[model samples]
Target: MLAVAMLLTLGLGGPWSGAEKAEAAPAFAKGADISWVPGMEAQGYTWKDKNGNTRDIIDILKNDYQINSVRIRVFVNPSNDYGNGYMNKDRAATLAQRAKNAGMSIMLTLHYSDSWADPGKQTKPAAWQSYTFQQLMDAVWNHTRDVMYAMQAKGVTPDWVQIGNETNNGMLWEDGKASVNMKNYAWLVNTGNNAVKSVSSGTKTIVHLANGYDNALFVWNIGGLIANGATFDIIGMSLYPTASDWSTKVNQTITNANDMISRYGKQVMITEIGLDYNQATAAKSFVTDIKTKIRNIAGGNGLGVFYWEPQASPGYNGGYNKGAWQSNGRPTIALDGFIN
Candidate 1:
């Protein structure tokens, strides 16, 4: 049995026992963009009161809700400018410090891109726009090292890190795409693995995939990594109930999540999850179903849940892509329904 399962089993009564202590299912070890706060700070987005009160992420966590760990994304340079919101190193430090001061852990997610990178799209960061395969590998190595050094030097070391985000399709674009060449993919992955191995030896490295409910894809993508002998500590999945027929699909996701532990002999976590609180009723339904689904997953195999951007007020156009940050005219739908 996996250690997480064993630990979870060694509890009061059986799984459904009300007396049993139910641990929180954290959506992301830290959470998404909020995790990017540190990087945002590095890019020059500061929280300054009209009175000139300089408060960074620590204030948000300290005031809004208590946080234990932070998840930060490293983009090559999202805004193209030297300093902008899409995660530069300086912003990450400030948030990391807040997490540290608040006695929280840190999870580093290397997006391998300058801007938004997800299962839907994997645009290679412009800086690496023209690098050869080998050059790209070096970029990954140097970038990871530089970021880790900055965090560690400031006394904020991450407890967990991800080589790339939702790497189901592959990262670093046409070059790192799965069909391009398995050897190339392996090389890119190893570059990140070695980077973490070099600086934060204590950190658990994670490799993430998207659409947890899709069983065959999960097997194929992660199975490929295993075949190539890629080393990582965690198998992470992103579950967005609103993305599909969630209730029916969640069962498959649970099976896939548990199977990963057996398949890889490693821990698993719902590295990214959110029900799209765009509608309160839907949000409630999504939250209730997700809570049940996650409990089942945790019960069968030790795992965690991570809600993405739960606290984010709806962005302009209701967080639609290419939209600005504008209120969605709804009450803050707390994604913490499962974890909190």
Candidate 2:
């Protein structure tokens, strides 16, 4: 039993109950995106608990902080020559398995690109660059189906699946850019959602956008998706506030999230959120407050909050620095925000 506990603590073994385990399912999700785990591990980044004991970062979050879920990002065919590679389906599946074995709910986010896809850029995968808009839709559907099936084959059913990450501007470039062509974008989203349902009827589909603090943007983007008949179970947001305006942004995000639930009649999630290490206090306050507000959303429509790359290795050159860990692998107080 001690060995089992250690395995669970290290996230190397299947689920087991302890004093720390929640008596019931988490009322409001506490999540982290450990998508960079493989890359970080490959680069020889080590993680340890406050006591200085080496541990799996996922296990630390789940066992120590009450985090009940994890989010992973998948890139279709990312360049893997460098140790910094990501988005490959196989890597994602392996990580998903770890989360599943830890008994945490999994959220899979598909970028639908060969590299990063976000509000600023949504370049299509190179293989599909020559395909028409309709062909692109087919590709999206097939890829979604294949990924879902792959995870399912490993006994990892994603509780939530995001069609695209931070897609306020839309995905797949000009061919499926919602701002440029709402019809094509809507088609891609719906098709991706359908494919998720086909593979795992239990998985909830989400359409993510950046700037959770911007209500008008959500209104514009989500309104457009609805106007064009896009279907999804959840509306996802990426909330990253600077130190100067963190409180204001949090307030705005809460208001926006409530409005989205009331107007669109759909649930919402903080699909990605982060704060600088220097803002450790603010980070804790921000995470706790936003989670409280989300939990209090009228009708319980707010699903949860997820911190993006909270364990990011400082050595990586991807410009990510919102991790809750200090340089020595010990967690900063920023992670304390998840305690509640």
For residues 1-340, what per-residue lDDT tens digits would candidate 1 score against the true structure?
1222222223322232232111233443434346534334454554532234555545544344334455677776767543334667766666666666766667778888877677777788787889887678778877877787777767876777788999887788888886566556656676676666565555677888888877788777777776775666788888766535666666777788778777778777777766554454555456556555655554344445555644343442125221111143222334334334
How high a TM-score does candidate 2 get?
A: 0.91
Q: TM-score of the candidate numbered 1?
A: 0.75
Model 1 deviation from native, Cα RMSD in Å? 9.9
How far residue 320's Cα lies from its native spot in candidate 2, in Å, is 1.6
Reference-based lDDT, each prediction: 0.61, 0.81
lDDT of 2 by residue, 49-156 (tens): 879899988889998888899898888888854357575787888889888899898889999998888888999899999997767877887788778877877778
User: Distance from true position, residue 92, model 2, in Å?
Assistant: 0.5
Candidate 1 lDDT at 220 equals 79
